[model samples]
Target chain A: MKIETLFIDRAIRPCEEIDYIIQSTSLEPEYVENSKVVYDHVNLSDDPITKGKQTLYITENHGAVIKKCPGTSHYTCCDYTILHTGTFCTMDCSYCILQAYFHPPLLQYFVGQHKIDAALDEIFKENKTFRVGTGEFTDSLIWDKISNQPAKLVRKFADQARARSRSSNNNFSILELKTKTVNIDSLKDIDHNRKTVVAWSLNTPKVIKSEERGTASLSARLKAAKECERWGYRVAFHFDPIVIYQGCEEDYKEVIKSIFEGVRVDKNVDSSSDGVIKQSLGILPESIVWISIGTFRFMPQLKQIIENRFPKSTIAYGEFITGLDNKMRYFKPLRIKIYQKIVSFIRQYAPDVLIYFCMEDEEVWQKTIGFFPKKEGQLGAMLDRSVMERCKAC
Target chain B: MLNLQTTISNSALLKKRVKQVCLDAIDLSDESFKISSDNLFFSGNKSSSDNSLSNLTNLSNLALSIRLTGLINPIVLREIDDKYIVVSGFKRVSAMRSIGMRETPASILSHLDFDKDKTYDFRFYEVQSALIAISDNAFSRQLNVMEQARGVRLLKRFCSSYDIAQNSPAIFNVNMGESLINMLDDIANMPLSLHELIESDKLSMSSALKFKQYGYDKSLIESFATLFSKIKCSLSKQKEIITNIHEIAAREEISASDLIESKEISQILDSQSDNCSSNVNDENQKANLIRSILFNRRYPNLFKAKERFSNNLKMLNLNSGMKSDIKLDPPADFEGRDYTITLKFSTVEELAKKANILSALTKNPLFGDITD
Candidate 1:
């Protein structure tokens, strides 16, 4: 991530997070009364979407520290809880909902920890199982360019999991720190208690090149996942916003192959191998806790946003129809065909890997994966079971 | 009271401020100051423009009036390199020229008056001339969207985009923004056929941009203009037709012009003309049929799905006796699973009858899959 301009909110200026951000970046801090000032500054630029990434707003997290994912309940959601540490990402993606999600998107990180800690403490106190993640709104590791925020979160999740390890029931909390960056140095040697699932959002190489600008390359993300797994953390991968294009089936299949080949052999590989060379040390497939899949979908308003911001992008011009949830989705049979192909390829390597769809319908699940997780909150239960069996804390 | 005061004050101020006084009037009695019919005119080296212009409407009436009344309103001209360019009265000049009048009385911009040229701000004079031309037309009648767009384009040479943003609503009565400004610029520069179509209210501004963006040839655009001039369609419908054709052309790996010339569209036009060339009733029908044909070609999958749904629905044969009380509507586009069933029964006896009918209908073989 590149940090060219830094803004410190007056509400958070006296905090320690500001000191850390100032020391990490050489740019002089431009203190503002609120986020609107930074948004005004960013929207004045030629390209607010790209300009927003280079500008960072170190504001206070006054909103809800954690909340349900915005995927409407009408669609089949995984019931994942969002640890809202921030609001936007530095990465510029052509199909990114955040571009239209925020009212003039900016790189805003919520500083201070009491609100999130209080929210997580309540979650940990519950007897029910919960899946929590910080990557919902922003990439988990993007802040590592200037702050060790992910490590701080890992410590909190790990301590809670360790304290609750004695429980006999299958009740646990799993913190999934998902990212598309290779900033995993702070995560190493953090006593994570095998409770934090460090995950990566994977895509085809063509998609990464043409759509996801400034994100880590496929091999680099997989290598980072391998390193995180080697450091005793459960790793996960998300094949989300899977763009459909010519030869994308082959491209995504290659991504699935590269993912397994990069980290999911028989736990034996040379430490610095370029994927081919091997030794008696490698990451195991068991290190993968779960993988989530979702085809590219967007609100109708986002199409115009993408067209205006990324005029070269053709992602919105698919054989799309309004889905039940009113977001534009690929025609049903088309989504089924692509989903079946991608799932079969993923199963070729890690057959036992717990793969789930993010916001798919029951018909889609039945047609693509041969089962529907629709009855009695079955999808969330299935994910909770996956978390319990992988994390020793439950 | 304050609001009324503000409105009155703003109106008076606007009226006072817009009284442009930079003109150096020439005596019409002096033939030395007047330019003849042979003088050349261009839109000021193409830097300034009177764009989005077409043939003057009601030219015959104006010519008749000129023949009868003898050019009551003298034209105004500006000197340029021994030739003359029109400053105002564009329509009057065009009407006179159309009537083959070899000469006309006119006033020259006193370029020799030097009071208007003290600073030599050539850009200023060009803008002043364009503004005068626009105001003269606007004072008599409301300028159409095209004329407003042209005025903006011409003034933009002297005014910044910010100037347009600040003053456009007052000057042209059109809200100006970056995207709208660029779109209007494109509209101002569109080919004359598309311009005529928009100005005649046959086509719309959005449809004009669609044609311009596709880079369709003059023949194709003129085909649409001619079609629209006869068959009136809404702006959105016109846009839809052009957009679908554009997509279909790309999918077929052919140019849009080729698609317009293809037998599919040409046959539609030909069939309509063959039916009745002058029937007003056929115009809208022709438009709807053409729109449907283009829509069916553009969305093959959706269209096929709709057809399948319709065929399945027809299988119900609901036109049977006593089943007239029942109506079934499938989910739109077959994109959903919900089916709506309505029963028209007003009393218990009718309800019981409907119940018996519904019972018998459930036993029918096609009832189970009517939603398909």
Candidate 2:
């Protein structure tokens, strides 16, 4: 890969000395000579980077060392945690918020691994079983196109934690590099435990093909996820930005069907056998993949921004109304309808696996997941609590 | 869920002029008048694309409210492309529509609300041009001091551009554009109670206008907002703090930042930690002891605890698992509190299975009646 030179904004060009491989090899001298590069080196900056269909911004969030996300926003379906590697995506979804989030936006990767490391150290020292991922700001693995940075980070995390384990022993989760790209070959070589859950963002076939651009095909992404699962790595799937198109019901059904075909789950062993029959021979039918669905949602102002930025795109002009946060978008009934369909499908196919929504409220959690947390983080606590109860009973 | 049947009755409420008027008569050709029926109307949806119904729901609910009060607070509208556009009162329109009314009365006005010194209008002829620069089905722009100040200034500028009826109240006398802007700024800064008070007409302008300079933290504002919106409570400084603390505790886990932020609490914890470490040599000794103390117990007690806990948890988890098994129909035993649970036998085998669960419940004292 040849380097390209272009006048990139200073906002994206973080640390001056950084190694980057130019993904596009057809770089002219003019493209490379005048280019300004950005990296992540500063404290979290508020400036947003806006592109054609994407904009990236940063906010200071002090949250759980272990975050809960299967990607169900109260509005959208799946809510998964991204390690907040940086704030901007490389892919261009027509409905992406990045287009309006950043001004004069450029692809900016946060290069301040040291600050991240410090945060991780503080988090790991607490050693309170944390599950974190690094796919929030940007695609988890797209940086691999430039360099296998995530691979390096994961390696560093695994090594440091191992070293610390001998003295101040505490269990620490390394990282889950989630993506919609076929960028897992680099990750395959890295050693990871069940502590790391490699996740992928999936949408209905209609959504992935039409709305999400600059991303891998659904088949390619699923193939990679299946491979990861086959390698004995626990994986996650996100059905996010579940666009409410004309044939969305059928489209989502196909998605769930394909997921089952790809990732096998055993029905009889799931909650006992009456639902799906099993013989004494111990033969069991294949099951579906664990999945999470997030209804389509954006920040309150994002709809207006999308309207302001991509007025031609009908994705924003769907059936919507004002929600609790007062952003002008979708109506609740439609959202519930979409959510109910997706949940039922996931339940029917992948009966045993964990399924959840991203960023949803308590009511949706109860309605969809069938259990309300006594409090907010109780959803995550429930899983742990159940496991502990089961093991300790033995 | 707020019970649909439990909704407050409005039979005694007098309909406002806005609700009596026709929507078509009000000319909704202007793009702003036509709202897409997207899922954003519901609350707490994070997608920027989703519209928060706060403004819409508030406006409609306000209409329902004004109807109760026998008042018609005029909503400002603007003329765009020869059609009257509603810059506000979107909720009022929806509320009116919900009641099967066609038209609602509105106050016609200019759309420009900008700093008195500056003026620029974003044109929207074809819809596509209006959507060119943004994403996130919703808004992410932080309303900073600069934006708020600019809004305040702009409203003042726009107020002078519009006609003021002499009989209008004095609060409405000031640049309403500015008043609205200042009100929003106050809202941005105001405790939620004050916001609710303002929204619900519980707080007068004299009190709410004060919070513009001093901003309450988000929790205080949201709690105040919720109390005022839902419970229609008046906001006070002390109440704001209490409600905010309560709501925060309910929503988020207790964190170190939360513990440390309270200076006295931090001091107390620090002293405690210091006192504890004075007697222990191992760094993790305290943690291990705490863990053991928490987890260590008699096996018999633990076994009993596990059984009880599992049974309780199983009830919770069973709702999801047994959703198919459970029937929505009420039982014929005819006791309201007893909840006569009815089971629709899917097959003969399923009927036998239901009998088994019922028999088991009867057999074990721990298992209550399946028909809660």
Candidate 3:
């Protein structure tokens, strides 16, 4: 959160977003003729990754603002779309691919609002159901104090959803703002119309403390989700990069219980029934749309980075093999076993909620959830159906 | 015309400064004067007499160059009252003395330049001489590890006495940085055998430093060096073994030397054949045995569980006429929870054969033991 320096591109003229960001932070402005100065300085430092994290660069997107997710053909992708709002994240997870994916690893935020708007318009014109998220390259809410991108994008999607409803179209669009932060103040007063699903990437308390440096605690994330649900917003949970360690199953089970306890409620139960009556749980189960379970997987290059950066991390020591996508993944049976346990827990609590796998095969689906999507695009359609049904768009 | 004039004037000034500095310190009336090789003494403890200079493998080449060029470059010396001390060119001086040369060309720094005051700091003068020696060799060639270590040792000693920049280790031809200097310091204090291993390039500085830091006994380090030298394992493999062994010893609350002397490790070490017929397979087996033993000791529970699982798997004897057809799901190590048995078959007959094997395996008591 403490940015050491801010490098502004000379080509980027003053705008509301850039001005808001520059004024919100106390980091001295270092106006550069080109963005390469920040990159070269970061790369030449003693610890490039750490130094890069401390530095911030504001530049134009210079490319398509909306791009398809870089999913491999070997795996079953969910047809997720990435809104290229930024790159690099503040919070450090040991198995995070961004550590190796980016060369200099500087925290870069694109200030090309016109480009993003144009891309979104193109997406809306085509208007099939698309799950666009800004959490791929960076956390959606990390720049909450500096920039209003989350609220801006959330309102944009709300307007688009309204337009679609007025036109009586069956197809709907969902803007998913996924993050590890509990910074939901910007989303509090917005009329999202349930088109903006506030999602949190969840992990066990041990991982949250050890590997996910500078992230909101599990309780804090669930609390934020609860608040979002109360604000008439559908909420989602992603247990992605679930690490396997000693007692991880029990830890994850505790996390699941807390999630349901914090957000979902048994609406049929009355609080004043009898002596042993239990209060109706807070947030409605229907408001909770989908939960994705993805085990800890990493690009092959991340192994050495994790070893160097987080030497004490035992996450890489799990039984792993090169997956079809060429990422190091837990052995199939091992992944399936972890998934089955988690799915069983989720099913016990909220059976109607849409549960899907992120970048998994048909076999993993059948083995873990006892059923696989019949064909390609079924997973994406299932997610879209959840959006329309839960958000009352259909 | 201006550039040529500037170059000529700069050259004249440089010659004048060199002559003035030399004359102010010592009598240099005879510029090519010679001093007896025996009269030239090396001031520092790191000399050929201390066996530190024994690794200068290119000394013969230098001697050959001197014999041909007739000592074109004069060795720098410090005139301490009546004694002549060789400050730089220890190798050249030793080479000249070795070839029965009576005298050698030299440049003398008078007592004024290297004076011992009432508050005398011997290390200061030693470091000054070391800098000159390192600079003399900087253009000649790169310094070996031992030379770098010796130079850093002198610089560190001087920096401790004088207020100077103690960060960068890029002195002369050695640029190992400060951390390596610390490693070299630790290496310098290690036992002779460990030093020999490092000097011979059989063991790395990092591994040697780890051994020293972990308090590995001299005999244990020597034994590993000996075994590694025989097997000719790669540096990474050697590092793995050393690291795991150290961890196991620390975890078991025993000395590393004691762990090396354990029955299991000794057996693995002794299994290597010294005969000329020993092939690559034998060496690989030996390395594998050592690694397996170290891993077992490090993770006793996992190893025990794996052993039990393997034995139970053998008890099933679920041989479907081929080894690849039937296998345990999730394999060994219990990294995953599910223990379903998977059998692959191509035809109905093969499936029936696999079913029969599974049926027999189900009856075995060890079938239940496999998951446990």
* Winning candidate number (TM-score): 1
> Model 2: per-residue lDDT, tens digit, B1-372?
111111112111211123234465555444332222222233332222233445556556656775676435554455456455554454555566666665566654432354673533232211111111111111323322223332333233323212212211222222334345545445444453453344334444444443332233555444334422322223353243332333233223342135223553223223344464444433234333322332222122333434554565366333554334643322221111233446667689888877776565556544443333
Ranking by DockQ: 1, 3, 2
Candidate 2: what's its TM-score on chain B?
0.26
Docking class of 2: incorrect
Candidate 1: lDDT of B302? 74
lDDT of every predicted structure (CA atoms) = 0.72, 0.47, 0.70
Summarize candidate 1's per-residue lDDT along B268-351 as a digit string, tens digits. 565644475543256567688778787777666777777776786677766577778688776655556678889887899999
Runs in model 1 lying further than 4 Å from the true structure: A14-16, A166-170, A263-285, A348-351, B1-57, B63-73, B80-84, B94-105, B115-118, B173-182, B210-232, B245-298, B319-326, B343-358, B370-372
The C-alpha TM-scores of every prediction are 0.82, 0.42, 0.69
Which ten-residue region of model 2 chain A has the weakest summed lDDT?
A279-288
Specify the poorest-scoring 10-residue window by lDDT in model 3 chain B: B12-21
**What is the total number of backbone clashes in candidate 3?**
0
Over A1-394, each residue of candidate 3 has an lDDT whose tens digit, in order, gives 4678899998888888888988888766889998779999899898788787878899988887888887776667888999999988878888788889898898999997778888887888765888899999899999886889899998888888788877856677889999999888999999887788889999998998878988887766776787788889998999998887668899889888887775322322222235453322444678888999999999887876776687556666665657766788876666777899999988888999999999887778888888888677888899988987887642
Off by over 4 Å in 3: A263-284, A373-375, B1-128, B131-195, B204-232, B239-286, B294-372
Best by DockQ: 1
Q: Provide per-model DockQ scores.
A: 0.24, 0.01, 0.08
Per-prediction fnat values?
Answer: 0.15, 0.00, 0.00
Count of clashing residue pairs in every prediction:
5, 131, 0
Question: By DockQ, is 1 or 3 better?
Answer: 1
